[model samples]
Every structure is written in C-alpha cells, then in structure tokens.
Target: MQLADLRRYGASHTIIQSLRDIGIKDIYPPQLEALRLGLLSTKDSFVIASPTASGKTLIAEMAILKTIFEEVGKVIYLVPLRALAGEKYADFSRKYKPLGIKVGVATGDYDSRDPYLAAYNVIISTNEKMDSLLRHSSPWIHDITLVVADEIHLITDAHRGPTLEVVLARLRQTNPNIRVVALSATIRNVHDIARWLNARVLESTWRPVPLKEGIYFDKSILFDDGSHKEVEVATIYDPINIALSVLDEGGQALIFVNTRKSTESVAAQAAKEVGKRISDGERKVLEQASEEVLKALAEPTRICRRLGELVKYGVAFHHAGIHSRQRKIVEDFFRENRIKLLVATTTLAMGLNLPSRRVIIRDWWRYQPGYGMGPIPVMEIKQMGGRAGRPGYDDHGEAVLIAKSRRDQAFLFEKYVGGEPEQVISKLGTESALRSHILACVATFLAKSEGEILDFISYTFFAIHKDPTDILSIVREVLRFLIEEGMIKEEGGNLKATPFGTRVAQLYIDPLSAVIIRDALFKAEERDRDLTPFSFFHAISATPDMMVLRLRKRDYEKLTPHIVARKDEFLLPLPGEEDQEFLAQVKTALVFLEWIEETPEDKIVGGYHIGPGDMRALVELGEWLLYSSYEIGRVFKLRRAVKYLSPVRKRLAYGVKEELLELVALQGIGRVRGRNLFNAGYRTIRDLKKADIEALTKVPTIGKEMAKDIKRQVT
Candidate 1:
C-alpha cells in the first residue's frame, strides 16, 4: 500500500487522529497498523519486530503522539545510540513542536540535567542516560507513562545487556502500569521476551519491498529464489552492469562488507570495474562522491592513503571509524542517489534506515583474536539482507553472499538464508557484571538489605542457572564485600545504605571502581607522596586504543609507533610477558577497556560511557577513600582536600590535566613529548634529580637517546 493510503487509514484511528492534528501525514503502513493496535489493545507492553528500512520508528512516534494526546504523563523514547537519539530528537521536534509538545534529548555527555526536562512531553535519550536519570532520581522520570525501547533485542549484548535488563526491571517497579513498546528485528526469542515484559508480540516478515536471496560461488550464482534459476554470479552482477550499462540509471548502490578495510577494497574494485563502463559525466559524479567517502575514511595525516586511493576511481567505504557525521553524509548521498556504491561493515545491518537495490556480503567470516575466523552470525547477515530491495525503486531487491568453497556455499545458503536467528540471552549473572551492578544498587539505594538485593537480583534470567548453590556462593561474597566496605549497615534485621553508600550511589560509580580506589589508597599510604587522583583516573581509564596483537594486515604494523607511545605513557606492557602477576593486572585493564570500547555507542543508557562509567566509579571510590584516609580533611569539611585527592575528575571533565598544562607551558617541549617525559617521572623541575642520561634510558620504556634529551631539558 502507498504511504498516502496508510495515512488515510491512520486518520480514523484515535492515535493517528492526534498525530494528524500535529500535521504528520507520512505514516508507513506497518507503523500505522502497529500503533493503532498498540493503543487499542489491553496489553501494557507490546513488541514490534520488523525488517530494517520498514517504518518501525513510526510505530514509536505514534505511541508518543498518543501519550501526549491522553495527557497521562511524559513519554521516554529510548534509542540504542547517541547518534540515533540526536536523529530521533530532530525528527520528533519537527513533527511535535507546532502541536506544543516540547521535545528534549538527553544523551548525557551534553547538557545532561536539563531543568526543563520535566516540562517536555517527549524525551529522546540513550538507554544509559535514562538509567542514570533513574539512579539520580531525576524528577522528570517518575512521571513517565510510556517507555519505548528502540532496539530491545540488544539485551543479549554481554557488555551492555545487563544495564538494559536492570533498567527495564527498575522501570517496571517504578510504574507497573507504564506502556512499553519494544521494537526489534527478527529475533528468535520474541515469545520469551514478551513473557518477561508481559507484553504482546507482533512479529512480521512482511517488508514494504520484496527481498530476493541468493548465494554466489565460483563466479556463478548457486541459487536464485526469485526466479528459481541457476545463473552465474557474473550474471548476478548483470543488474549492476545494467545500472552501469546506461548513464541514465543515476542512483547509487550500497554494498555491505564485513570489515572496515574490505569496504574500501570492494568499493575501489567496483569503481575500477564500473569505471570501464560509465560515461565521463557519470564518472565525474562518481569520483566526487568517492572523494567524499575517502576523506571520511582517512584519519591522522592520511595514514590509510592506499585505502583512500580506491575512492579516486569512484569507490568509497563506510564504517564506525569514519565518524558519525561522515557516515550520515554518505547515507544522505545514497538516499539522494548522488553516490553510486557504499561498501560498509555489519554495522549497516542494525537499522540505520539506508536502503540500496543490491546488498552483497563480500566475506562471511571475520578474523577475531584467539577465536580465529568464524562465520558471521545468521541474524546479522539476515539484517543486512533485509536492507536490500529499496522501496519504490525496485520490484525485487537482491542479497548476495560470496562463498569460497562448496561446503562454505552450502553453509551460507542453509544457515544464513534458511536458519532462524539465535535467541537473545541474558549476561546479567556473570561474576564481574553482578559484582559491579550490585555495588551500584547499594550506592543508589536500589537494594538496601542483602535479602532485598538478592531478591531483586533473583528476578533476573541470570538467577535461572543450573547450579543454585554456585549462585548463592557468589551472592554471599558480594554481601561480605558490601559489609566490609561499610556501604551497608545491618540494623534491626534490615540493611541500610550508610552515608558512604549514599555518596557512592549519588556518584553513580560501579562497585569495581571502589575496589580499585581502595587498592590505590593502600598503595599511596605505603608511599609518602600523594598520588594525583587524576593520574590514577587516567591510568585506570586509558584503554588500549591502538594494540592489535591479533593477526592483521602487514600495513597495520605502521600503527606500532602510535601504539607503543600510548602504551609507554599508560604503563601498559606489551602482551607477551611471562610474569603472571603483572600479566593478570594487564588482563584486567584489557577487559575493562574492552567493556568500555565494545559498549555499543548507541547503548550507553544513562549519559554514561562505559569508559566514563569506569572513570566515575574510580572518582567515587577515591572520594570514599579520602574520607577514610584523612579524617581531618573530612572533619574540617574542606572541599579542596577531597577535591585534591581526585584531580582526574577535573582532568576528565576538561580533557586537559594540570601536569599536561604545566608541560605545555615549558619551552621547547610539545604536548606529545611532554606527556612522555611526565609519564617517565619528570613531573616537575625538582624531579629532574632522579633523571640521569643513562639512568633515564634504563627506565622501563625510555631509550638512551630520549634519556639524553631529558638530561638536556633538565640542564
């Protein structure tokens, strides 16, 4: 059905009537139907699982519109990414502004606590921001009548899944009657999710456009379900060749690659092949588009110059490293039919709303460290497949998977095309996650007594493990830690958060941060010099941004200079070492970094970057440690003494540390080398006494030549 017909159908519905009153006419059919049923149904919660490019967002918009019309309370539209939150905020503001529905976006890093947040009818935010607001007891959140989770299936993500689960549980507790609309792609455990949320499941395989799936192997098409024909893979390229066959078919094509490097490679190869076919005019436009794409992909003085060269021939790449604005620009060009082809990573699979006539998977397996090369999950491949078949442009869209061997081709055809997506599992009970979140609960007053906390945690799927005894043992250790920390005081058979507990809660730090801070404080007591809180914070927060010990291309070796420099300053040793104790610490740091970096940028719930979360947790732990260390500082009620303990807080907030500032002010020293010297123990001119030319060279990372330079600087 046409969009006009869908709008007309929506006109009769009460929710759509309200939306129309606000001047919204471009309602997609599936969205309109889902919205209408969501409003009319008795279910408090509902799940809308549809393919990518389908109007899943419109379903959310309709619910927000209905909530505004009913005047019950505020509406919370939760998205997976900060970029998505910004995009949705703009869209909602444009549609809802004239109707007097004030829209506000809270992504946490910017203007986190807006005073007018409560006044706004619609609040678009990342899930983490919402969690923070809930933890901080933001007044606006208590009145939320509708909660719309955009990527509900992400609860399976090990790093981020726990936060989403806890947030949902907390929201349910706060407002049992709240209307929840969970949107996802085709997931296997929709029923279980429905049961968990007590929501109705609305699952549909229908796409506004039809998708044709096939496998390409040995230059031949193994199968084409659309026409039930077996043609060569070269013939499958016929349509692409046809698009290039004439200059008039001006629209661009999007090719999905599994890796960032491959995106550039495929685009370059396609451009070379297509360059032989297209006219000068077409080539000019393609080259310009390709240039824009290359500039987006290039970074730090054109480090990937070879990759960028592909774009000169009218090919470009898209991936997370390109930056959000660049990705958006590419999407806009493709939408406007300005660019011809976009080679992108699996990230293109998750609901970016970009459509193309043909989607190709160049590689089915991606190499991961330790795990080696494994097959791409079927769900991700299917999501990319769904992106094929642009509505209105093509009668049928094509999704091609290029396989290497006969067995590989069979696996792709059977597992990706025919198999169901995996079930979304909970990662809540993992020892690390449980310990951290339980501390957060104690700090935030979510769980007061040991029994109360255990009871709440038992509601999680993590509690459903096969060994109940093992679970109880884990819970016991967590309780003991809390008791020893004095975060919880057992009084009259009930556990209450002490002042220390309340402070940690208000800070919204992870429990692990407290442990780290306590350890740092003990070490500091052994040494007479006061450890700069900011130094500690940066040390803890600096995740390895540039190490790829895993097998990568030879060119990746160029990154060694940058990686070694960061590792030296951060005091991070290279991966190969027999010292188990130091290795264990390095492993912990790596795990923390992985958690921080791997957290989906879109999934940061409450204005918290898992990186920043780790940092904030450390700051809170430092504060608690300071209170424990100097009772006089606590008694005098001196802010600066406590503040001085955690200098990293200011450094983190400003992105400039006092030591860095001091180093930058020095003559003949640049920021890069200044940081190097400072990390090497020359913090001030007085510390130069410790620096001898040869002795400085002997320092773990500093070489003899750098030691000579340090001696000259001291002189």
Candidate 2:
C-alpha cells in the first residue's frame, strides 16, 4: 500500500503530504499489513509486533496525527526513556507543527500544579513521569484520546514493568473508551500482550533491511544462511577487526560490549585501526565532533577527553558514563556517517534510532553483582541485532556474535542466534512496586475502599495473567505495612491515605524511602548529637531509588573501620540483618559525602571505583531523596535535621558546600561559578547585590555577560 492510502484510513491530507515530503511515499510492507489489520481505522486498540526500523514509529505517527485531526482528544505518546521522549517530541514537533499539531514533552520534572501540557495536542512522556502525573491526578489525563505505548515489551522488565502495567490499567479504568496503541519489537506470545490491552494483534517479521545473522571465529564469519566471509583480525577480540571490515565496505558498524570500560577500550582500539585509513575530509569531520565533545564539558572530564581523542579518528563510544548531551552529540555524529564505528554498552539496545550495516556482539555474557556471570538473554541479543540495516542506507545488514572457540561458538549460535525471544511477564505484584502504586491510588482518591483498590489492581497485566488470590494477598500485606508505618490508616472499613501518605505520593517517592527517612530522623532527634551529611547519605542510599556502590574487599576493610568509628554520628544504627548490603550503602553514602565536599570527579572515580554514569545517577537520586527526606523531616518535626538538611540538599544539587548555596540559585551559575563568586567575596545574594558588574566579571569562571545576568538575578 502507498503512504497516500493512509488518507483512506482517516489520515488527513496534511499527514499524507508530510509523509510524501519525507520521501515516505510508499508504506513499508509491515506497516501496510498493520493498516490492513485496522490499526488506525478501528476504534479498538492495537499491539503492533514488528522489528525495529520497520515503520512501527510511522504507524504510531499516523495514528497520533489521525486522532488529533479528528479532534478526538489529546494524545499521549509514552516512551520508555527520557532520551526517547525528547527524540519523539522533536520528531513529532518538527514534522507535525507545520501541519497544526502542538507537541509537548514532560519528563524529569513532575510539577503537578502546572498542567503546562494541557495546551498540547500530543504529549510525549516516560512511563514513570506519566505514572507520576496520573498519581497527581493531572486534569489533562482524562482528556487523553489516543495512548501510544512505545516499547510495550518493557512490561517484562522487573524494575519498570509494574509502573507501565499499573499506569495502563489506571488509564483504561479512567478512560475506558480511550484508544491504545502499543508498538513493540518481536517477542514470544505477542497475543498475550494483545489480550491484556484488548487490542488486535498485527504480527510482522519483515525488515526494511534484511538482516544476516552469523558467528565470527578465527577471522571468518559463518553466516546462518550457510554463507562465509573472511575478515581481517589482528586483535584478541575482533570487534574492531569486524568494524574495520564493515568500514571498508562503506557502512557503519555498532559494536555491543558488556561494560563501559569495554566500550572505551574498543572505541580507542577501533580508532587506532581506522585512523590510518581516514581521509583528510573525514579527519576534519572528526575534528568538529571532537570540538563539540570538549564544548559539552567545560573542564573536559576524563570521559570527555577519552571520547574526544577517539572521535578524532571517526570512532566513538557511547554509554551512560558519558553525559546525556555529549552522548547525543556522538549519536548525531554517527547518524551523519562521519563516525564509522560506535562502541556501546547495553544502552544501545534500548529504543535508540541508531542503525548500522553491521552489528557485532562483543560480549554474550554479563556480570551481575550477585550472580557472577550469566549469558545474555536471547531477547537482548535480538534487540542489539535489530540495530543493523538502516532502511534507506543499507541494502542488507549483518548481526554477528564473536566466539573464541568452536564449543563456545556452538553455544552462542544455539542460545542467541537460534533462540526465540522471551515473552513478557507481569511484575505488577512485586512487594515494593505494589506498595508504591497502592499508596498512589489511595492518596489520589482513585480508590477509596479496599474493594475499589482491588478492582483497580485487578485491571493490571499481573491480574490478567495470574490468579487474583495472590495479588489480593500481596496488596493486603502492603496495606498493613503502610498503616504500620503511618503512611495510611483504615477508617470506617475503608483504606484512606493519611496526610503523610498523600505527601509521599505527591513527592513521587517510594513509601519505603519515607519510612527510612522517618526512622533516621526519629533516631537522630531522639538523641542530641551532631548529624553529619554522611549519616543522611547513608539513609538515602539504602532507599530503593539510590544505586548502592559495590564495596571491594580492601575498600570494605578501609570503610568498615571508618563506619565503625563514625557509628555515633549516624542517626539510626545501621541495619544488622544484611551486613553486605549495609556496607555497600555505607560505601555509597561515603562517596556521596565526598561528592558534596567538592571532591574532584576523577579522583572519586579512581579512589571509589565509581564511574561517571554512576556519579551522575548518584547525584540525581540523592538530590531527590534529600528533598524528600527534608520534607518528611518537616512533617515529623525534626527541626534540627530539617534545618541542617535544607542547605545540604542545595549543596548536593549544585556540587557546592553550604557556603555557596546562596550564590548557586542565580541564573547562569553552577558549582564552578558558585565557588568562584564565594571565593571572590560574594558569599551571599546580599554580597552579589552590593557588587558591581566589573567586580563580578573579575571573578573566576564568570564572564561579562554572565556577570550581567547574575547582577540582574540578584537585583
């Protein structure tokens, strides 16, 4: 079917014209099959099971534009990650704004008081942000007409699955007639998901660029289709060798490694190989990308320097360790074909619109802290493979797994190449996920009674797949715990969220996080002792949201003594039940305390064995939890801790000590500027207000324009 034919399925002329303008005159075969299956035409929901880059997004675009054109209502396009949300918002806004569509993105900040998205025709958000909005009972959600769940298969994800499942269930309950659209990659038992959403199933294995799967051994790749190709190999791991071969063929390659360290190592190695082959023009392009990398980092962090050095050879690495903007720059460079190779971690597997002619799986086994090393899931392997074959650029793509031995080669082929992707499983009934959602439901008055709460939960994917008895039992247990913790209370035989419960939900923090904060505050206030930042850091690190750093044996031995020495300074006694987990939390808190003390990032990484990604993650989660802890402290009347925590939270956020908190609040200011101003006799807003623009500009890290901006802010 032609793209113009979508008009018959209720796509407006503007939509069709937009499609044509982008050279999408003909609909891809898989999307055509879905259209024939009444994906956009029908009022019912749809679960589109297809490969990545197979026009799933276009199908969703058609639906979103069609629904908005009909004046049906506002549309919600849900993506799994903030990056995907930003990408979708940009794409939709760019293409459809001219066609009279108003698109808005909501992520990171969930200010319930501001329904800024109400004016938008289409709203793009992450699953968690959407869930938070729903919990806040945002007035705009009820107006939602079309709901698109991109990466619907994430329902199998244990950490994220419950929120998606419960959010969908709530939307279904609130707006029963709302149209749902789920776009997914190939997964086993697609019909089960279809059954959960009450949507028609459109299954297509067709790829816009046909993929060739193979196993690489001893410089030769044995294709699954019984074809063979000899490739050069001079390194121990031949991902770089395979990538060099792909570059020789005039196509880009994506090398998937298991760790960030491997990504940098492989990119550096690949750059060395490709450097010799780079042309002058290509060298110029690489230089531009390198400049952008440095510009993204003011002081050129270690990761930035490494990335900039590698990109000079038309090769780069991407992982969470790199800043988001820097990563986006790398992606843009790769998209323009200036970069020949992108070495990445499992982060690439999650819905990024990056495609290449060749994908090399450098590691098939992943190391988990508790489980040692385990083979990668078949679905993960498939997701990485799906990155191959840019539709317009490559006629065909290749996905190959590397093996060192024949026995290992056979196992790789049997387990990943020949294996079927796993089916989605519901995790809605997990104790913590269940508790958080249940509190949200009660706090927002979505479910007033136990029966109503049960009914609400009954609509989840967990209830659809399993017996109700188990879920009901878990819900009751969670309710009892919440009541015991003073988050909720039972009155007149109906469960009601207390003021504390409502605050917890409004803060978008886990109920268990509040519990830990309350316990820590109570213990601290119970006695009259000094409360240190390390004490509170330890408290927040043990919360569900904070990622605990792993403590090596030598590190643990070093920290164990410090922790023991500082035992009196901690608010609550450390948990004695789980020694290892407690020690890890202590290690995490120590690192955080060091961070707030203005420790150098590279020094922290070297001493604590934490990555840039982990530091970024730690700061973000720690700041939020600190705010939550402060609010909870205020609620419980821990006056001393509350006063101490307020300034400390600001310090944690701006990466400054308490003295710079007053200056960091100004516009065009951050840690570096905040410190500079403080060191330059501008310790507070009053000092800044009294200073002249010349004095401000004389301060280190502050220029004329920035000084004027600071003056304006202070005055």
Candidate 3:
C-alpha cells in the first residue's frame, strides 16, 4: 500500500492534501495500501489492530474526516479516559476548527445541552458520557453518521467492556449505514472481532519507528531478534542510563513505572543523572521548565504532583491520580521535545500520541487479588514496548526490562517481550453492568415490551447467537420491577416510560440508583423521619469517594510518629493518653491511603479500602437516589421528605464533610456504622449523654465499655 495508490483508488483529494500539508507526503507503503483497498471496501464495523505507536489513530482520523467532509452528520469519537478525550478534542479542534469543522467534548466532568451536541461536527467523549447521552435521548445522537471506538480492546474489561459493547451494538443497529472505526493495540482476536462486525480487518505489525526488545540480565543486554549481548544492570547508572543514551543520540525517552510514587522517584533520579550530563545553559533551561512543572505537581492530586516533579527536573510522570490539565501539560511538553523523559504508568500506553526513542519497563508484574505480583499480560506490555520509537527522530527504539534474576529475565524475554497478546472476550453478560444498562434501556424507551425488548437485547453481542434462557428470565424480572414501581405501563403492545421514568431519564441515573432509593424510601416509610438524609447520601457517594490504597511506608516505625504529630498539630483531643480513638481514625484513613498507592500496581478491588472506580459508582448511585426520591416526593407531595433530603443532597454534591473524621473515629464505626449511629439519637458528642448505656451497648453489637468509651470520646 502506498500514498500514490491511495490517490489512484479514489481517496478524497482533501485527505491527501491534508497529509501533505502535515509533511507526511510519503505514507508507509503498507498503511497506504490498507487505507486505499482494505478500509474503503468495509461496510461492517472493523478494528485496525496494530502495534502501539502505530498510525492506527491516523487511519481513524482519516475515516472520521472523510465522514465529516461527506455530510453534516456528527462523528462520535469514544475514548477510555476523560483525559484522552480532552487531548484528542484539542488536537482535532486545532486542525479542523479553522477549516469550519466544529468539535465538542462531553466527558464525565462536564455536562452541556443536547442542542450544542447537534451543532458540533465531531464530539469526543468517554464511554460513560456517551452512554449517558444515549440514555437521555440526546437529539443529536441520531444525527451521528460515524462512531470511532478508540481503545476498542477495552471491550474485554469486565467493568466497562459491557457498556462499550452495548453502546456499539445499539449505535450500529440504530443507523445501519453508520461508519464504525474501532482502533486498538494488537490483540489476538482481530479475526473474531472482524467476524462479529462483518468488517474488514487491517492487521499490521509494521512500525513507523523500529522497536528493539532486550532484557537486562547479569549486567548484560540480551536482544530478542536472535542477537544476544550482555548489559550489566549494576554497572548501568540506572534505567535512565538507556534514556540518557537515547537523548545523547538526539532521541527522547518514555519510562513506565508501575506506580505514581515510582514515577516520581524515577523522574527525580533520572533528572539528577541527566542534569550532570548537560551543559550549564541547558541545565538552566531544564531548571526553569522544572519550576513550572513542580508548581503543577503540588496540586494535591497524584497526577499533578508527579507531572509537576518531572517537569521541574525536565522530566514528568503520567497517571490517573493527576488532574487532566497537568497530564495535558506533560503530553504537550513531551510532544514538543520540551521534556526529555516521562516516567509514567500504563496509562501512557493507551493511544496517547507521545512517542519516544526508548521505553524502560521498571516492573513487569503487578499485584492483583487472588494473585499477588502476577505477570502483566503480554498484550499490555507489548503496548508499552510499542511506544519505544519516534517516527522522525529515530531509526530504531530500544525497550529494556530490568531483570533481577536469570529466571525473571527469561520470563520477560520469552513470555512478555516475545509473545502475542491474549484474545479479546465479550463482557455483555456480566450481571452487575448488564442489569444497570438493561434498566437504563427500559427507562430510555429503547426497550418498549417484554418481547420487543428481548429482541432488541438479542442484537447485543452478549445475546448474539447465545442461549437466552437465563437472560430472558433476568430481563423479565427487571421489567416486572419497572411495572411494579409504576415506572413503565404496558399500553397496547408497547411499554411507555411513565412520569417516574421520565424523571429518572431526566436525571440520568443508573437503575441501581432506583434500587437504592426504593430501599431507602421503604425504610423511611416504615419509620418516618428515622433515616437521616445524610446517611442515604453518604451511601450513594461512598463508592465514588473510595480512595486509592497508599503504599506502605518504608518505616512502619514512622506511622505512629506521623499520627502523633498530626494530632498535636491539629489540636485533636484524644480519648486518653494512648489516644486510641485518634489512632483508630488514623488507621482507617491509612487503609484508604495505602489502597490508593497500591491500586495502580495491584488490580485489587474492594481491598479493604475504596478507590476512584468505587467512588464513581457511588456518585452515580447518589444521583440516581436523588432522582428517584424527587420523583416519589413529587408523586405523593411529600414535601417534608424532599426538604429534609435536600441538604444531604447538597453535601453529596460538594463532597463528604470534614466532620466525617470525627464520625470515622467512633469505635466500631465504618461508614455505614457511623451513619447508623448518627441517625439513632446520636447526632453529636453531646447527644451521647442522653442515651442509656446498656441500650447503647445493645445497638448493633456495642458493649458497655465500647459505649462508655464512645461517649467519653465524644464528650
């Protein structure tokens, strides 16, 4: 495939002209052929599975630009992360906006009107936002003529894969002629995906910049292409040794560490080493850049701090913990060669445009539940390796793994560096996600009847040619719940979204929100005014506010010192000299702190602490809870319930209160426990004076001493 061939095969002159304008006159022969013949013939959905840092995104952009120039219909560019969507939106907007193309972004953090959605030629969004837009029946959605599922390989992720699959299936069915462009790092099941979508597969192993794979064993570099050499790890300055070598050769580097802390640690170390090598003037320039970067990193969030630290050192880190703006700065800096090195997490591998001449993997195994310190899948590691080369800067890029032992070195060489990626599987049938989306579909009027809804669902990848025996039963039960709640009414042959349904739709909540709200309402009605509004709100927000596990400090001895220091500084009174109450609260918060530190390195969920994913789920739950309560309040005119709940709703919107610290410090109290205690005649420390000691003990397993201690602590 060649650029000339694409011209001969009827590619729009505009696309060719744009490529030329970007100084890309010579398209790699294979990619050019794929665009000219392979993509042009496709009528079904297809994925371009290729190496990381390949021109897969360019292919997607070409398809999208073609669709935009051909008609007024909208193009939906779906990415996995909010940051990526924002980055892509800016990229596309800068290029196309001046050319009269309007690009809009709808990510998780922002919500705008549907009218604006229609006005934009391209809308870049996260999958969740896209799902929300669809559920809200955004008028512009139907105007979509093209959908690009970037990072399409995520269809295999358990938590989000089902949502992506359902959305894609729904979009394709709604507009049979809509062009679908699915881009992914090389996956094992390109054929399976192609067969499912009935679209042509343009699979490539070609790299615009060559990537060389090697293992560091016994201080030796062992190359994979039947070429072997020894690189002593001990004699090597650090992972930055290879990075400095690349830069000295006039190329940049992207070093991936498994954690944010490691990212910062490595960047600091690399900057010191790289600093010693540069001229005084160059060092000053780096130091100036580093100062700006440090300011951003100090912003409290993990990503900002990491990037900030890296920028100060003329290096930066990329991860989810940092805010989006800081991540963008790092990306822009790297893209323009302002920053020479980036110590990042696996997030850097996910379709971001920054490429480097060297990629060093600090750790290959991450901890996960049921398997501690397990090997990363070959596919993911490959994606990181694929980012090793820069198209214009380097003829070859080096990917190095630091191996502690020969066995480890062998594992890296044979299993990760030399292996194919795993097959992509469908997540359509997962109960947790499926149940929510199914209810969402009913609420949105996409599923109108038991039979019609069933048929519509059958079109999903989950039900495609699979036995629906259990699925049918599940859908029936959900529909019955809808009817019982008066959310839907069967009229003639169609099921209609009643007033309640409309409210849920308007609020953009998950069905699980309805479930939680119904439970809360039942409890409220059983014992009127017994349930504190904040308790319900907390329940809804807890999942989303779950913190990442903090990494264990090197000195467990320092833990107590830090706790004592914090209490002294804050002037927090303790129950006794031992300060058990304060200690307990510190421990609880530490649990969350530790969880945040470990989450990136350990794929542990529900690991004794809550994290961002859990927090997101909770936020959605809270929104749904409020929406449901509002609807019920409207129906029965329960003004009091609505009034009492409003403040709690406001609290949830803003965030958990600092008073939650006092609540967390109470003995035998978790989030739920604190909520229950506060609701049960114990709203404040003074209220404990009014309670019967024995009776308080009897309240959910508290004993006499525990009750006395709680009271004493509160006082």
Which candidate model has the greater lDDT, 1 or 3? 3
Better of 2 and 3 by lDDT: 2
Candidate 2 lDDT over residue span 1-715, tens digit each: 7666676666667767767764577788877777777765677799998987888888887777668776568999988898899998888888777767788998885436348889999999899999889878889888998999999998988888888888899999989998889998899989988888899998888998999999999889998899999998756558888888888888999999999888988888777778877889989989988999987754457888888998999889888768787889889999999888998897457955789999999888898756788888888889899889988899999999999999988988888888899978897777888888999999988887778888887788887778657767788898889999998898898789988898898888889888988898887676666678888888898888788887787875787687778887776665663488888888888888887888877777778865566678789889989998988888888898898888888888877787777777887687777777777788988888899998888888789999999888877
Q: lDDT values of the candidates?
A: 0.60, 0.84, 0.64
Put the candidates in lDDT order, highest first: 2, 3, 1
Best by TM-score: 2
Looking at candidate 1, what is the lDDT of residue 689? 54
Q: Candidate 1: worst 10 consecutive residues by lDDT?
A: 543-552
Model 3 spans with C-alpha error above 4 angstroms:
1-5, 18-24, 38-45, 109-113, 228-248, 294-310, 369-372, 463-465, 468-470, 473-509, 521-537, 542-638, 644-715
Q: Estimate each model's TM-score.
A: 0.73, 0.96, 0.75
Q: Candidate 1: lDDT of 522?
A: 43
RMSD of each: 10.6, 2.1, 12.8
